[model samples]
Target: MNKYLWRRIKYFILCIAGLLLALLIWGVIEPYYLDREAVVAEIPLLSPSWQGKKIAVVSDFQIGMWMANTRTVAQSIDRIVAERPAAALIAGDFVYKPGDNLTPELDRVIQLVRPLVVAQIPTYAVLGNHDYGAKAVTEASASDIQRADRIQQALEASGIQVLKNEAIVLPNADRTAENDRLYLVGIGAYLPKQSQPQQAIAQVPSSAARFVLMHNPGSFAELPPGTAPIAVAGHTHGGQIRIPFLPEWSWMSFVEERSSWSWISQIRGDIVRVSGWIPGYGNADNRLYINRGIGFSNLPIRFNCRPELTVFTLQAKT
Candidate 1:
């Protein structure tokens, strides 16, 4: 080969090598890096006394997955404790494929989340599809119910309140007056039709500031207008591998469709909505925020998407 052609060949080889190295770091190293995102939310009807209080949100531990990011989960919880948020919210999917034996996974999950209890930070959670072992079961079976209950019991034992279609008024450090209270409503997983937004919201007094916690973003649609001033969710994992400018190529699409992958879904942008605020969702009064959780599913690698711990500062709406 001539000198110019040889130079061209060398350049081509170097470009290919560089691309592989980038992909390797993105897919392997990125997943292990946890991101702490701070956001400010202005909630309607929020009490002045509760203004500027921070709430930490994390989700989808998926403990049993091969090469799961359990270390990240533990570290994230520790950070939440250190931040000393008024409360920490776990959006769910505590284990991945615990199968018939859930004891080991449950123990691992409890151990990872125990730090929050030790730190005395109030924590709340809701179960996801994986926790119920009903990823594919639209109608929950007896086994599924048992699995969900076991997971819930373990979390509760570890000092995390597992709310299923329940609402509680968060006690304010200042006062217990009606105007000072903020309601937190947590509903069940949307998969298997377990989420009951109406029933959960019923417990919240009207004209009070309320926030909802759920495992699936789909549940936000079930909420009536003005019921959820703000809501938080997980289970998308930010598409697990978000291709820049090509969100439609997310791997979550395949998992959601589950054997019915289609060009139409891609063209219509039906891929799972990922982290941060979801635009044009729910009524004008309802807002939803999805957290990018610190775990893996379908595969253990993540590219262009890092695990997240969200710290939200609540501001009283003007």
Candidate 2:
């Protein structure tokens, strides 16, 4: 072969070999490293008399992703249990895709999460964009809805209350007519296709000490004035990547109007509410905690940002 042709051939072979090596490394190291991140933040929310009661937050269970393993998720739940939280809040995306396995995977999740519920920790969940994305996999809108409903049902059966833009007052253990300390309000997925936030917050009493749960962080914008003391959300997955000094703009840029990358924002209004991200607790009122989600999305690889299970300790400010 001519020198020119030989050189070209060698370069091409080298390129292919490099690509293969990169893929191999990613396949082996990605799953273990990406899937193995400790639950980062332990937020403290002060109540009048409640001192050390903790609420565990688990979000973005994008099951069925190539990078996410069911075992890892179960382990994460186990960690949450170890924290001995008073309650567990799940912000949506229970399934990666709507498929025959979707229901089964959801069932598996229920079984794994059942112990936590049985432990008497009030578990609450809200749907996410992916849960409703079953239309893409099922091909039929009705089937998608049915599949989502099934997931919800399974969760409820396992003792997790599925909140669809509804408010449920959580009674204190004291049950004393005097100590009405905790209230949990959940909003549905923040899709225009699903329920509306305005309608959801309407159900909650403005004067109550509320913890609002919603799928998308952006939904906080729509909350009625003086709605909640703390809002928990999951969807951004901490941008899925963190570069040194450079922000993860891939998802933030497009979602700027809908969900800004700002993890914490104070909603100035009659009530002066605050909306904070719940994936990894960015720059919000120290009250908002954004969990770095348990499952993977789109690319199936997590860099810098690892999955997290957050535990928030609600204490008395005084």
Best by TM-score: 1
lDDT of candidate 1 vs native?
0.84
lDDT on C-alpha atoms for all candidate structures: 0.84, 0.64
Which residue pairs overlap in candidate 1's backbone? none
The lDDT leader among the candidates is 1
lDDT of 2: 0.64
Q: What tens digits encode model 1's per-residue C-alpha lDDT throughout 238-296?
A: 88887887754677766764522221222223543567887666765888898989999
Stretches > 4 Å off in candidate 1: 1-14, 246-249, 258-273
Residues 1-318 of candidate 2: C-alpha lDDT, one tens digit per residue: 999999999999999999978865654454344232323232233344445666777787777767665665777788777777767888998887767567667766777788787677778899887787731212336766777788888888888899988888765674444345566778876543565667776775544456778877666666654455467788777665444345433433343343333323433323211112333332334234456676766666655555666676664432
- Segments of candidate 2 deviating more than 4 angstroms: 1-47, 134-140, 248-288, 316-318
Cα misplacement distance, residue 91 of candidate 1 (Å): 0.4
Model 1: what TM-score? 0.91
